[model samples]
Target chain A: MEQKKVILIIDDDPDIRSALRVMLESAGFVVGEAANGEEGLKAVQRIQPDAVIIDLMMENVDSGSQVAIKLKEDKYPGPMYMLSSAGDAVRYNIDARELGLAGIFQKPVDPKVFISTLKAKLGVA
Target chain B: MADSSGKYSQSVLSKIIRFFLRDEEGSFPVFLHSLRLEDQLYDFTIVRFSVAFLIIAGSLFAKYILEISQLNHYALIILAIILFFANTINFLIAYPARKKKEKSSAYRFLLIFILHLSIATDFIFLTIALWLVGGVYSPFQTFFIFHVIIASVLFSPLISFAYTIYGYLLFLTLAIVSWKQWLPPIFPIGAVPSDAPPTGKYIITVAVVQGLLFFLTASLTTHLMYFLREGQRQIVRINKDLERLCDQRKGFLQIALHNLRAPISAIAMHLQNLLYGYGGELNDNQKSWVQRSLTRIDELISFLHDLENLSVMENADLLREANEFGLNDLIEKIIEENQDLILSKNHEIKIELPEGKIFILGIQRLIREAILNFLTNAIKYTPPNGKIIVRAYRYSSCVRVEVEDNGIGISKEDIPKLFREFVRLKNQKREGVDTTGSGLGLFIVRQVIESHGGKVFVKSEPGKGSIFGFELPIHIKK
Candidate 1:
């Protein structure tokens, strides 16, 4: 049996995390969730998921950037996808390509497109 | 009711004090006093005190001189003391009198006329003293022109002429009295001057000189006053126009900001859900489309942010908390952060920064926004293979930052309004570049610079490229 690909969803909004978990699970990937950057960092350390999706503006403001920066510095070998609101684009000074990002998913994420993007980035197709 | 009455009484007391303190040359006292019973009482008290002071001073000076006057010495002394006492009694009686009257133009005219009358009386007395002593040869007559000049300055020609006529009449009366020997020849101390002219010629010469002085002084003063008044009127009109323009600008900004909020919020909300996967799973093609949507949303968000900043700046409440930061560090951070966008556009960003440390005092967030806005515009406008140069140098008292682009430059006509909100350059409009700009980038840039007591200047011409530069006061700290 092929092992299930694990995906971590880090977002301060519970609704977002839950919705993303449903979409990723339905797409045939194992999913984990964390409500903040700190929790997300710990989850990444424990699970070392195949892919990580993080929200740019979280509880502490720029929490997702902090997580991404940490993951990059620590040489986390997985594709990182950033989920951000339109407002966060300028606020977090986010440049997806420069940050070694697989892609950026702006908020109100289209479930069909996001799951497919995750599947592609994670090589789950 | 009692509280209001108490306040009213206090107000009355204050008015009375002001009435006494103010210069009383015009019907200002009568006009002010007529409004309320209390003010009238105050005015009367002030007038009585003034009259008393004059009478006492006059009597003392008269007693010391002119010992052999025709009038009885005892009668003059008695009359002066009586007048002084009468003034004091009137002042005491008027303090509580409460018969308020409406302000009337008659009162204003009378007050002004009385002021002129008193001045005329003073001139008459001086002329009489001069005529009694030796007429035209009197040193006092030489200074009589000074009084005419002063009258011309303070009063209108009509008033001055009226006073002059009164002066002449008093002089004539005194001359007649001296001629008939009814008044003593209070001249020469003991021996009349041997060169003394006949009294008629002396009087005529004095009258002629005074009349000429009065007319000349009056005309010159009138012209001078008219010129000053006209200049003051022009200044007042200009200030009024500036105030109206400022008010209109404020109104425009208010409406613009209010109109922009709804669309920006809608875009943000929709973009939020799409980025968070709220709908359903997607394919690779769908993923690309969603990403494009996200980029569009980002552009709109940036535009709205610029609009908000411009509104804040217009209100003069753009609060900036200053911190010391290195210019090169910030520029590098921006470049490092925006490398992907630059690469995607197939453009190059060249940096020519000073090696030495250049520190500036600014809010870190605002400076970052301003620089990022400039860089974004540079990238957006520059064509593929275009170049952007971000340069910084230390000039006297300031640090200059220049962002030069070898892209389409603004036309000369549009340069003047380049830093105004919602003002796109004519060239940019003609080039038909689908720039997702708020047309507020340079506006915000100028505002931020001005708040720092600095300035932003742009040099651009059609097709020649443009250099947007700003200078900030250098901060030695850090």
Candidate 2:
């Protein structure tokens, strides 16, 4: 029996997190949720999900980017994805891949494509 | 009988004065180009009064000294008459041009005519007075130099030279006629037996020397005036270039600000998610409608981006190519564009337009954008089922178009800051609706209206209603 792959969703908005959780769960991945950047960081330390999804703007704007930088400094070996409502990662000039991020997904994420990209980065069969 | 005669004589005197000071036919406008028309008229008035005073005082002094033979009293009387005519003609021209505030080429020509006639008349009268005194040896010959200097300062080099040559000829003609005894001799009142009029070679020497003095004065003064004028023109040219550079810099700043944050990013994401079925499974009917709505939203985003840049451009010549447009047709199209939003909100829009065409001159696209912004703002702030009234009518010399809404009106403090860029008011809420905006809409609206030489107005009160409008000058074709 294979362990169910877990994905952690980090966003301040409840609606955004639940929609993403439902989509990821239906795609055959176990999904956990964190309400803000600080809770997301604690979840990363405790559960250590297969991949972490983060919203770029939280109660403190740029909180998502701060999480990524902190993970890199702590030598946390896991994939991170940044989500934003203002702009794309590339347009905002945030080099997600260089910051040890798997990729970025914009708000109201396209579930199929986003899941497929994340699975590819994680080397899922 | 006395009153009628007095009125009749005044009318006749005015008629003669007007005839003398009328606009000169075919005078060159090029001469008036460097001088301010109003200043030239003012200078003419000053010169006329000063010359009249100098002539009166000079002739009276020479009379008391008995420097002339029998023609002393005659010279005094003739000089007085010339002074009166010169001052009267000047007053006639200056007062009317000043009162009417006339800047036409004809008015300018009238000023130049006053300059020419006054100079000629003063020189001719002074020369005759000098002739009645001591002919070629009169002490007042130095005044011709003063006249030449005044001519050079008032007119262009060519015109000044012409006046100088005319004065020379008049003086020479008077000297020759008196010397050759071609005209009757009226000797000075107290001329001694030995005080014979200087003759032949002596008189010729005096005439040639005076001619040289006139030419020198005209040349030097006219040359200096042209140099000063050229310097002023260069300064004006530099000032215009600096203004254009400043406008370009402002345009750059606007572009930088517009691109700094992508305001449409959230809308793009949500629309993409719905159309691609990321939000959840959708019926075939739902998928088709979302896709269509997405296309329209994309178009609107691009238009807003374009407007963000366009509002900051202040190039006058580029915006001057305006065409006639009907205000009613434009409003109809704007309403049609926002049909879906209005329908979603269930808002009742009341449109009141005057009969016939309300035509105005402006860039149609810009005016359309302005109206679109106002309408969009009204729809956004108004609750579902709220009323909107759009009215267009002619007000005084301008055509005013207004959008009035009974919605969550702006507070008194926020009204003053509404037109500023990126200034969204705090604590904005209306029941279940939460308003989100970039705050660039009204800023663009004010920019568009003001660039057309028009004004924008706003009247709003908390919770009652808000009215936003602009007035544009009506374009009447000849």
Candidate 3:
């Protein structure tokens, strides 16, 4: 029996998280959820998911990139992606590759493309 | 510009000039570069005070420290005391006015009057001191150049020239008259080498040469003042224009960002639900809802397209894919894309093109958008079932495209304002017309056409119709 690939989702908007959860679940991946960057950090520690998808979630404790940097410093061995709502992720001026992000997925991500990108980066089916 | 310490001084100075100098409104900061009248007065006041104090210290230093005979320490000391007392009394009155926030108009009038009197008195005392020291041969006569320079910085060129002449006349009268055998002068001032009586020709020649030098000083300083004032005014004007442009850019971005973010997010949630089969396979009702959402998304995409087109033209960016392309082909493609809207509105759009392929050299991206803007504008402004005639033809070296509609036309007064950013005509609304224009379309068209060294044309009668379009040169200058 094969084990399910676990993906963590971090977003302040409940609707966005639930919508993403349904898509990922349908794609045969277990989805973990957190409301903000702090909970996301704790979730990363607890769940140890294979891949992490975080929202921009501005006007909260720390921005999306700050959480990514902290998780990397904490030695969270997982591929990370940012789901940005502000048109695109490049506007933040954050270097995705340097920040150890596999890629940036613009908000309202197409499920097929999102899953495929994750599969390619994680080297999974 | 009005600092806290100098606020009172400025208000008073401006008030005085407003009341007294009728021509001040026409030309301001007339002498000093950017200094207000009050700031210039303060500078003049400080310089006058320092000079008076320096004269007293300088005479005392020379009389006691160096101790040269025939120095006439008695006369110089008396002149220095008079200058010092006169300046001190004026300073006492002006100093309180400079500090006080609310001064009466009468007091302000007095302070302004005192400043003029102070400058006038400086000339008399300095001239006397110069005569006592050595008359025409006085080394301290060099200070007269500074006097002329200050006058030029404060007054107009003609007045400064007159003041320079006054200085020379004083020198000739005092030094030349007292030395005459026939003149009953109380005391006589002399040349540097007074052992032998100097020739009258030598004295007259020195006075003439000194007068020319004073005139030169006045002319040069006034010239410098004119250039400085002009340059400062230019910088201030440029700064105001830059601020206005920045404000316009800020407003544009706010509108663009708000329009992009909200609807896209709303559409995205529904799209993910329908496309990914969030719960299960959708029924017919759910399918119709999804279809409507998709249509909304299409509208959003077109709006985003317009935004991107306007922004690129705003930046005047040259597209990297720019190459020779057919103008007729671009227009035909745009019409085809908008065919559905035209048919639905029942607008009969007739396009007239040149016989063969008319090619133009430039970025196709902006030109395509510009023509699309024209076609769409004509379609929207005209009533349902109206005639929209689009013509593209050769005019010597240029290609002209016109979108003529016998629908609602612009008024004569409003025609000039048609191509400006965010301009909606007063009478643009009509039955069965899409009056919801972003108002940026024609502005973008004008920018694109003019940037190619081409021109836009509009001819209209309010009740009859309007012809709106642009001409682009085949060989565009890079």
Q: Find the 10 residues in a row with the least total lDDT in model 3 chain B.
A: B182-191
* Chain B TM-score for candidate 3: 0.46
Evaluate model 1 with DockQ and give the value.
0.07
Q: Candidate 2: list runs displaced more than 4 Å.
A: A1-125, B1-227, B243-313, B316-320, B343-346, B383-385, B394-398, B413-447, B450-454, B473-478
Give the docking tier of candidate 1: incorrect
* Best prediction by DockQ: 3
Instruction: Tell me the TM-score of model 2.
Output: 0.46
* Residues A46-86, model 2: lDDT tens digits: 89898889888777757788888888888877788778542
CAPRI quality of model 3: incorrect
> lDDT tens digits, residues A36-86, model 1?
999999999999999999988777767787889899999999999888653
How does each model score on lDDT?
Answer: 0.66, 0.71, 0.70
Pairs that collide in candidate 3 are: none
Which prediction has more favorable TM-score, 1 or 3? 1
lDDT of 3 at B165: 80
- Candidate 1 vs candidate 3, DockQ winner: 3
- Please provide the root mean square deviation of candidate 3 (C-alpha atoms, Å): 17.8
TM-score of each model's chain B? 0.44, 0.52, 0.46
State in Å the error of residue B405, model 2.
1.4
lDDT of 2 by residue, B1-478 (tens): 1343234234666556445443344222222233565556655665566666766776666567655546466556667766877678687777677557547887688777776777788788777776766666666678778888877877779988998999888888878877887866666545423355558897688788888888988889899878977887898999999988887877775556345433344455455566666567789899888767765655455345444434433443324657787788878755753454465567899888888877878777677767766786788788888899888998998989899988889999889898877677887787734366666667777877887878888999988889999999988765
